[model samples]
Target: MRLLHTMLRVGDLDRSIAFYTDILGMKLLRRQDYPEGRFTLAFVGYQPESEGAVLELTHNWDTASYELGNGYGHIALGVPDAYAACEAIRAAGGKVVREAGPMKHGTTVIAFVDDPDGYKIELIQRD
Candidate 1:
């Protein structure tokens, strides 16, 4: 079976959506509010959900933040140029936790940016 979307709990739904859509160049696929559960779910991606996996942003009405435990790693995105991606992310008001450079002990270039909710996104240079 194909993989689906990855879910992340965000403190502010609008801010998180702006980071993914405005900074990361992703589209807001869909969003729905669960009134009974006091939460909202918004989906975003580079393509249609049927074409590839997407991201699910969950906002709980009563929760302002979450502790990102050590178990959660960053989400990776393939880019034509890790350096350019880092620059663009920074220009778009994103936080670059790591500059673009060859991965430690490897030749592959990589960089990192943090979302509004402090979720890490890895940019990997691809041919």
Candidate 2:
């Protein structure tokens, strides 16, 4: 079966939306608020959801923060130029935890950036 979407609990919906959309160059594919559940779900991605998988940012009305236990790893996004992507993200006020460079024990270029809630996102360079 194919993967659908990755759900992340964010503290500030607006801030997280900005980071994912503006900084990462993703589009807000779809969004809906679950009033009964006291939460909102916003899906973001590089293109329309009909094209491929996307990310779901879930904002619980009562949660101001999340632990993000050690078991969770970072989400990765493919880029045409890792170095240039990192530079653009930085210029847009995104936090680049790791500079773009060759990956450890490998030649693939990669970089890391942090979201509003401290979730790590990896940028991998692909032809």
Per-model TM-score, in order, reads 0.98, 0.96
Misplaced by over 4 Å in model 1 are none
Please report, as a residue range, the 10-residue window in candidate 1 with the lowest summed lDDT: 116-125
- All-Cα superposition RMSD per candidate: 0.6, 0.9
Reference-based TM-score, model 1: 0.98
Task: Please count the clashing residue pairs in each candidate, in the order shown.
Answer: 0, 0
Residue clash pairs of candidate 2: none
How do the residues 51-113 of candidate 1 rate in per-residue lDDT, one tens digit apiece? 999999999999999999999999999999999999899999999999999999999999999
